[model samples]
Target: MSFVLLVTLTVIEIVLLVLVLAIMVTMVTRQLRSIAANLARVAFGVRAVETQVSAIGPGVTEVNRLLRDINGTLPRVAQRAEQLAR
Candidate 1:
């Protein structure tokens, strides 16, 4: 009788452990899907930022070129102004 009772209890414990593991697997799968979706959204956002930066690149280069041209002319203009004053 004691042996029968021990066997029954052991079977029940195994069944419960299996149920717990199934539940844990289901929960982990759900969380992984959510994490994947979030990562995809982040990837999309990063791509958008990259596109905007690319679009700005030529405009920024043009502005820098203009600034360099103006910087090159400033000393000549100042020298002319001083000559006029003299």
Candidate 2:
């Protein structure tokens, strides 16, 4: 082949290779972005669960307080009933 033809072929080959690499890079970047978005959504869901679980402590505390109040009143009622029986 003539030197000029060989040089032209080489240039075309280089350009094609560069284009393919660019396309592959863009595809990979797109996939990475999608994965990052999914991970963010998962993180948000986890945070919501954490907030719900954290609230359970105070809820349980309120229930315990209500039970204690009810228990305290029962003893007084029992003592009054015994006195009446005497």
Flag regions of model 2 displaced more than 4 Å.
57-86
Clashes of each: 0, 0
Candidate 1 TM-score to native: 0.66
Give RMSD to native, each candidate: 4.3, 8.2
Clashing pairs in 2: none
lDDT of 1 by residue, 1-86 (tens): 69999999999999999999999999999999999999999999999999889988989989999999999999999999999999
Q: Write the per-residue lDDT of candidate 2 for residues 1-86, one digit (tens) a residue.
A: 99999999999999999999999999999999999999999999999999889979888999999999999899999999999999
lDDT of each: 0.98, 0.97
